[model samples]
Target: MLRADVRAARKRLTGRIRTTPVFHTSVNGPNGQVPVTLKLEYLQHGGTFKVRGSLNAMLAADPAADRVIIASGGNAGIAAALAAAALGISCTVVVPESAPHTKVAAMWSHGAEVLWHGTTYAEAHRYATDLAAERNALPLHAFDLPAVVAGVGVVGLELEEQVRGRPPILVAVGGGGLMAGIAAALGRRRQVIGVEPEGMPILRAALSADRPVEVGASGLVADGLWASRIGDIALDVARRYGVRSVLVSDDAIAAARDYLWREFRIVVELAGAAALAAVQSGVYAPPAGERPVIVLCGANAELGG
Candidate 1:
């Protein structure tokens, strides 16, 4: 998707979603305290940034369509359900058994018909695709579609106004939709770094292979970051924009989550902390004077003390 498409998506979702805030802070790094900006997108509606794309896609579709179907690990399904609720359409979300109960409950609370299928998101997606055809429901992909990718690109546009200079952006990737959108929107204006769980480095693997390839998903944040393969559309955008990928360990991800809560009193899911983990763990280091912006993408998982 192009920058113009992202602007059109922003127009379509003007009043539907929240323009989340950005906060500046100094984080303890291998060298010293590294200054950084955190885009607080976890505060977004449906408890994640997925709502931006979900709302935009639903709005662009025919209003007369009664049913919409999607498969998600968690965040995207909740976003789709909330969007469908707002549009007064029926939504059915098929999620893998490994999905967090908190997310499934949130979808149910949003009035969506929830189905538990398969052990992994990829398996659930296959089931959802078949069900969508059987039900004749308008299928909404969690990522990979042009409209969804364009809608997510709006985050980059918002950041342009929020950040003073074009700072390198670190974003967590699952299916690569959010990273692709941001890369497309920013378009070489800023460096886009994609972070993923070491165990589920779908985008990293895809980039290395020069195409989408299946990867095993086994990590603390598997539910959110577990995509067997990166989407084709996302891969194309990443290649076009020269986006780079990094891998973070589950240990680092857990530490980042704890650090966010202990230091900033901010709570985020495992996937949400992946980007920060890259910096905190020294996997993706920035220049001494450069202050990179990290996108805190979601907080949909259950909070435990």
Candidate 2:
């Protein structure tokens, strides 16, 4: 995926997706008060940026297909369901048994046939692929295809238009699709920092190995960042665009999520808070006079009344 591909995706998704807002504010980081820009993509349709990729993949592929199958920990399944519904297609989502109840319920509400299988997203992905092959249904991956990554690049395209000077961007990483798309969209102009949970450091491990490597997934934030390996496309883009990787502890992620709620009244899932955790915990501190942008990428949490 590249900037041109991303621009084409934006044109295709002109009215199908939303142009989420951006908020500029100051927050007390470990260093001191820091000015930051927040890309409020958590408020996106299906409660996450995955909707962009899901919708784009379906639209770019065979829109006349009647049935589609997808596997996700939560957010991607909700996105696939939403996209399938919009395209008037039947969708079956296979998710790990441990996926959050709220996300599963949202998928069901979107008219998807929800199936629970295995305990990890990798296992569920295998099952979903097999089922799709057997049923002759179109299969949608969470974050690996060209159309999907190109669609996700729209986020960075919007960020470039919304923020000035091409500041560094902090985004949470799962399979590395979001980070890759953003990096491809920016074309090595701006820095893109990928944040991941310490326990499930898929991108970090891949960077260390100079290839996409499988990692054990276990963390408080694993519900959203459970990909065992980074996608090949993400690794290629990261290598080409100098994408940086950082890790944050589960405790830091929890604290960051709570801080957003208390200070900004923002409700985000643990994964959504990972990038902020990198900033708040001083894991990826910016240089002096460098303003950074943090992306709140998902809001699939079960907010109690």
Candidate 3:
């Protein structure tokens, strides 16, 4: 059912979004001589990859689904709101206290009612779940559903089309949605790696503990990467597909972001910079005779840089 659903999502998502391009980046990392392919997904409209899954969820679920509700730290909410607006449906997003004012404003700008829940994502999710049930709204999961995962997989499928062969390494992670989609899309391929910030190693910690444990959010990348726990759906997909997880630090991510601005002349958010941090900081050193790919997932940033 999940596989079929994902396929349907891919079909539904076609022509609805831009398939961002991939280019071999020349940035030198601590890991010796390895060419890197950058999956420039930030070029996609809505300024991030969230639109893929948001649109997919909206299209796949009951179109008659009145009042869609979602829980998000930010990006997903904006995506949900945009999707709902396009579909002519209403949406409400519950966000954590830590969610930036900019994000809440963005959600509101897209026509989503923003409610501040507790201090963390889990608490917000619970509140959103209750509100969704109470309002008789259909829930659009932030991450962790076959439809959502498949929509994200479109990024991977497009990457595969661009690369056409094993790239030796590819990296991405979020609330585990992007990684789950990439992993399922790449199935059994050992090179696609999932990278997370040290403080929000929901997926990595899950791999170590063999279960998803609540890890309070911390780090610059905390905005998008830190979910108290990995999505149960994401964890299952990851574990079943043998995806590897690694952690990088806030400092490394900052440097990576600076590097992108300085060298590549690109703008990306903290969560979007993790894979670059992993390589440059030696958090994820590539093996000899292997290539690497970094998923530049988003660019939801404060303007006037």
Candidate 4:
């Protein structure tokens, strides 16, 4: 999508979505403390940035459509459910059996019909599509659609206003919807980096192969970042905007999560800490005097004692 499309999405999302706050902080670097900003998008409605795209897509669709169907491991399902609830539309979310119980419960709380279909997101997606066809319901992809991508691009616009210089923004990727929106919105104005799990390096593998490819998704954050293939629109936007990828191990991700809670009193899901893990683990080193922005993408974890 283009900047104009993102702008339109932003306008449509004005009051519907939360303008998630950005926390200005510094992270220890090779030299010293390097300035950084954390976009606390995990605090958004449904505990993820996915709601932005979900709301935008639903707003543009026919209002007469009674139901909307989508397949998600967690965050996207919650997003669609929340959006559907806001618009008074029925929502059906098909999630993998491995999805977190807290997320499924949240969808149920939103009055959605939830189904456990398979072990992987791809399988759940197939079932969701078939069910939508059978019911003649509107179907929504977690990522890949123009409206969804454009809707997510609003985060970049908000960041531009929240920070001083155009710093590189580190985003955790699942299906690459959020990354594509931010990259297309910012264009060449700022650098965009995609952080993925080492096992599920969807964007990295796709970039290397010069096309979208399926990769195995198995890790601590698999439920949240478990898209086997990056979306086609995301890949195209990444190429056009020079989006780079960084891989982080599950151990590093866990460490990052602990560090956030210990230092900043921030508790987030494993996928939420992936971008910070890249910096803390030294996988994606930032140059001296360079300030980067990291996006904490989701907060759908069960906080148990």
Best by lDDT: 4
Candidate 1 clash pair list: none
Which residue runs does candidate 2 get wrong by more than 4 Å?
A: 222-225
Model 1, TM vs. native: 0.96
TM-scores of the models, in the order given: 0.96, 0.96, 0.92, 0.96
Clashing pairs in 2: none
Residue 119, candidate 1: C-alpha displacement in angstroms:
1.4
> Taking the tens digit of each residue's C-alpha lDDT, what string does model 2 give over 92-116?
9998888888889999999999999
The superposed Cα distance between candidate 4 and the true structure at residue 99, in angstroms, equals 1.3
Who is ahead in TM-score, 3 or 4?
A: 4
Q: Write the per-residue lDDT of candidate 3 for residues 1-305, one digit (tens) a residue.
A: 14455567778988888989888766768845456788898887777788899888878886567688999887888888888888888999998888877777888888888888887777888898999899999888888766777888777777767885676444657788888877777676545678888877788888888888877677565553257788887888778887888788888888988899998889988778888888888877766655688888888876653
For 186-286, candidate 4 gives per-residue lDDT tens digits of 99999999999898999999999999998866766455338899999999999999999999999888888888889998889888999998888888887
Candidate 2 vs candidate 3: the TM-score winner is 2
Instruction: Answer with 2 or 3, whichever has the higher lDDT.
Output: 2
Against the reference, the lDDT scores of all candidates come to: 0.89, 0.89, 0.79, 0.90
lDDT of 1 by residue, 166-228 (tens): 889999998899998999888999999999888888888888999999987676654532778
- Number of residue pairs clashing in candidate 1, backbone atoms closer than 3 angstroms, sequence gap of 3 or more or interchain: 0
Candidates, ranked, TM-score? 1, 2, 4, 3
- Per-residue lDDT, model 4, residue 162, is 91
